[model samples]
Target: MTLDWEPAAGRPDLLADPVAEAILKGGLTGGPEGGRKVDVAAIDPTLSDTAAFCERYGVAPEDSANCVIVAAKRGGEVRYAAVMVLAVHRADVNGVIRRHLDARKASFASQAEAVELTGMEYGGITPIGLPADWPVLVDENVTRRPFIVIGSGVRRSKLALSGEALVAVTGGQVLALTV
Candidate 1:
């Protein structure tokens, strides 16, 4: 349950990814007790999706956090958020999220929109470097893991850290957000 991350520049796949670079450079805000923050582990850049990543890295699906961008609209205002949930479950986007956002409806953001808005690849958008104004919703289950593996906003690497550090980095609200 410990975080072991190497410098991103030492890995070619991660050297050019901004989000991965941000995590490696200590750009995320907030600190847990003892001043421990966050860290990144550069993996094979070709592991482009969650399933491949976990299996290749000897990580379990339940131990990896998935970041999903969701949106809703009311009165012509679209509210967007990047929600974190473990790979073992799904985000209650149409239920808990619709209620949380106070919108008439909610749905996952399109891949194109998510990539464009987050400035991260479709398979790698993470909560760490999301737009400052976007709220990060973390599933209560996700925060319970001693350590969680997450996307680094690029296909080339992953970020690994404590669950508490995740809450701190995203400034997230822990809730029963999975179905």
Candidate 2:
């Protein structure tokens, strides 16, 4: 099924504040018109989760990406990062991700922390507009996809863009982030 895709640059109404700001500011380049080619579509808020969204939208598991927030702690310091993986796979949070963050332990961030820190709803966090200091780790498999669906930083909508575009917009690091 076709989603009502529209240029993300022009659809701030469908985006959360940070998401709209990121796209409007031209992604990471910070140029006058440096936004990546992204599309947005409104969806049922109750079905915003990966499985429900994919099923209701007729999106394949491999064509949908989930962005999870990780809290890595070491030596009394805590850092947060965003991990992007296909819905079909799970992010290696305790293994590869922990090592990558140079932390003694890594796990999913608390919903309150994620929502507060990212200025996004709990179930609607996207890699885009994440804090610059936070690393965005994209699973290699995700980068190979021509297009994928991800959250719009709000439960009411979804974003669609090429995996390459996602990397460019978020300055994502491509790696074997999934197991």
Q: Please state the error at residue 80 of candidate 1 in Å.
A: 0.7
Find the candidate with the highest TM-score and give its number: 2
List residue ranges in candidate 2 displaced over 4 A.
Answer: 27-36
Q: Which stretches of candidate 1 lie over 4 Å from their true place?
A: 1-4, 7-36
What would the TM-score be for candidate 2 when compared with the true structure?
0.94
What TM-score, over all chains together, does every model reach? 0.84, 0.94
Error of 1 at 164 (Å): 0.9
Q: Per-residue CA lDDT of candidate 1, range 60-120, in tens?
A: 8998999999988889899899899999999999999889989897999999999888888
How many Å off is the CA of 176 in candidate 1? 0.7
Q: What is the lDDT of residue 26 in candidate 1?
A: 54
Best by lDDT: 2
Would you give me the overall lDDT of model 2? 0.88
